[model samples]
Target chain A: MSSADLRAISQLDEASRKDIAQWVENEMAQAKLRSTIHNFTEICFRKCVTSIGTQTLAKTEELCLQNCLNRFLDTNSAIVKLIQEQNK
Target chain B: MAFFGKDSEASSTQTQDVKQRVMQEAAQELAVADVTELINNMTKVCYDLCFPNPGPILTSADSKCTEQCSKKFMAAWNIISQTYASRLRQ
Candidate 1:
């Protein structure tokens, strides 16, 4: 590492180092959220929207999009549960 | 000779300054990434939904469809984001 890198790390107190680490962890979680939201939006949009000319979502389409998120989460958990069961 | 160029107190203050700057930079980057992602997704979803066919002229219907498509896409994005966030909390 360069002198600057060494100096930077050395400068941080334990608490400051922990705070920086926590901030980075939080940012990573946020980045994951952004990725998931983008993906889910596309997936649900395709599933829910058929005719796209309406100014407002039809009642059925709105419900489908809402349910899509729940089902997506449910499916994810179910898959994880299945994997855990298989591993055991 | 100490490896650290600065004394303890000075180093702590310097570290705080750096930490603040780093966080601000990260937040700015996150904001930019969010807006870029939104625009890209909006363009893709709206184009597919609104302009299913190619036409030389942009009709009123096409613009209206694109507007609604943008709104619905945003709504879906928010709903999914919230749902994922809630699930993460559990």
Candidate 2:
């Protein structure tokens, strides 16, 4: 990651600095979401689609992709829940 | 008093300038990062789908295959994004 222009940020008033910090946090959140989705697509594509000759995705392939995504998300939440329970 | 007045006015303008610069830079950085990720994934997925039999040149068939592969990859990406967003809300 590029080092943020800290000198410029330091010139802002407290309120303005707070606003900038909030905005940057939101932007980072969105970027994180995008990267996660990209990763999921790569994994699900490998799992769901075995053939590639056709220009269009077969209906079965589409369904497989969706199921792959659903299962992945399910696993994610289940693991998070398990971790929380373990901590408790 | 003179120095304080001048310094406050000058610093306020500088603050405004800096705020705009920081916000613009942040947005630009995020956009570049996102686009780079998309391009990288597209390259990898399309290469895999279209280059199973490697050739020196990309034939018309290979080009078509790559195009379709990219489209399918994008479609999958959208589906995953939607599913993940909904999962997060839950």
Candidate 3:
């Protein structure tokens, strides 16, 4: 990190520092979540689209990608809601 | 007439301006970092996806691999985001 980085970071008070840290942590966690989703799709399509026979993706594999993406999000959201309910 | 709270309001506004500036700067840094990261990751992923194997040294063919990979990765991101957003609303 450079002096500019230290300047920007040092401007924050304790509460502000904590708030910014949490914000960054949350964004990074979400970024990782998204990267994993993308990787999952990339690998799945590669596995299913073997042989290099078709120039375009198969309709079924496309559908599978759609379903896979949603189901993954659905799984996460469902868990989140369940946890929220438990906490209440 | 005398006023005791006027300076407090002035100081509060100055503080508010500082807070706003800090927040804006922070948001901008995060946005820039996110964009650069996305581009870097997309480049790497696209390269691997398009050219799984390479020789000891990359040739002109490998250069095209990187180009095509970026184009397709962007297309995929656009399609996926749009498709998901529409399906999400319904």
Candidate 4:
């Protein structure tokens, strides 16, 4: 939003201002979620689907995509945990 | 405070209308951004998978491979979305 938009929002009543703030927060969270999913899908697709022989994914390919997503998340948390432990 | 102030009431309504319009615009902008990212990512990934080598002209086989690659890419996206959502719920 522009600074002018911010000034307009600030002119709103307290309740209206709170509602708008909440909505903006929700929109931001949703955008982040979408971006994460998009990145994951691209990464897993590249790793699992080596060949595009058919319109439908092969059984192994589907399983690999699922496994790839799960492992990526697992790796994320595992690294976070190790970092937290080191800080302690 | 003037509970019956005509000017106050009119301005309040205007404020509400403005708020609604801004929210709607923000929602639409976010949706468009998400779709733009999806299309760009799809094009890059599918192009790499379907066309490993550049050709002087597009061939039927290349076209067919591109079609199949796009479909499979969507399938992968759906599966990944579901898996990610479920994991978040857990």
Candidate 5:
């Protein structure tokens, strides 16, 4: 974010500035998604791939990784739901 | 004598070009940053997985394990990306 040249954006015309704003918003969302995936991958990799046996992931290891991701999301939602209930 | 409109038109076009270039540069910078972060995380995760004991130098076996661990890490990333994207869509 600090690397970006904000001065250039300010010099743009109104229309061009609006276009850039929309494009940047989309890009930021995508970037957030990518970072989230990176975090989830690190977590699941540690949990699932306990040992490094081969270059390729074993069947169980792959399944475990997928399940770990799904369950993690489920857990996230469940916690949010619990918080909402507590507030109400 | 009536070149004022044409002058403004050219300036607008120039502005458009500048905007496009700025967007491209910003996008490239962000992409590079993302890759750097990913590599940093991978290094930490794989190093711990591959080298349980600290040795003076990396042996061939440890090197191979590091390679495999990186591959598995990337695979896990792909799976998570796909799963998360689909879930977001749903």
Candidate 6:
């Protein structure tokens, strides 16, 4: 039988066994999340920095950039929250 | 590396039997695309910030200024990301 068949059977006939499968899937999902955060940070850093020297980020620039990142996340969360809030 | 088991039979069992394991791969792909979109948005703003004057539109073998500008812009983006995330965590 195909693997799908095995999975279907496992879900229905072998409930206890399915617990292991669920845990593995969640771990994979978490790994994906970690990588995503890393990738975004890497590129965002590249676009923001202008000068070649190791000078510290200026206060105004730092605040603005920080705002940029937070606002982006906020926008995403707000959109979803608003959608659900409105729909429900 | 973790997936590779003692034998072929064991490895297949790890890969095929676990439905949850697939979620990691899906999450990775989604994150990659999300990051790309973020970079694109940030760059547009940076380009405008750096090059207020409508200079040459950046060809591959272009002027030195264009190269320098691109580098600095990326640096700003990085700073913003680090500063922003750290501040939020605080």
Best by DockQ: 4
Positional deviation of residue B57's Cα in model 1 after best superposition, in angstroms = 4.0
| Per-residue alpha-carbon lDDT of candidate 6 for residues B1-90, written as tens digits (9 for 90 to 100) | 222222223244454544344444545665676667655654564455445676556654334444555555555556655665575587
Per-residue CA lDDT of model 1 for B1-90, tens digit only, reads 223345344465677787777677768878888889888988987888777786999998888888888887887777777777777798
**Per-residue lDDT tens digits of candidate 5, residues A1-88?**
3323455455555666678778888999888888888889999989999899788888898889889989999999999999999999
Which residue pairs in candidate 3 collide? none
lDDT of 5 by residue, B37-89 (tens): 89998999998888888799979999889889888888888888888878889
**All models: lDDT?**
0.77, 0.77, 0.56, 0.86, 0.81, 0.53
lDDT of 2 by residue, B1-84 (tens): 111111122277777887787788778878998889998988987887778879988799988888888888777777777777
For A1-88, candidate 1 gives per-residue lDDT tens digits of 2455446645667676668678878987888778778988888888898777666677787778878988988999899999999999
Q: What TM-score, computed on C-alpha atoms, does each candidate reach?
A: 0.77, 0.82, 0.52, 0.87, 0.89, 0.38
Candidate 5 chain A has its poorest 10 consecutive residues by lDDT at A1-10
State residue A42's C-alpha deviation in candidate 4, in Å. 0.8
- Scored by TM-score, the top model is 5
- Which pairs clash (backbone N, Cα, C closer than 3 Å) in model 5? none
What RMSD does model 5 have? 5.7
TM-score of model 3 relative to the true fold? 0.52
Rank by TM-score, descending?
5, 4, 2, 1, 3, 6
Give the per-residue lDDT of model 6 (tens digit) for A1-88: 2455344334332343455456557766765654555455544444444433333555665565666667667787899999999999
Off-target runs (Cα >4 Å) in candidate 6 are A1-59, B1-62, B87-90
Would you list the clashing residue pairs of candidate 4?
none
Model 4 earns a TM-score of 0.87
lDDT of 5 at B10: 27
Winner on TM-score (1 vs 2): 2
Docking class of 2: acceptable
Which interface RMSD does candidate 6 score?
Answer: 9.5
Residues B1-90, candidate 3, lDDT per residue (tens digit)? 121112222244544554456556656766676667667666656555656776788787677656655554554554455556665688
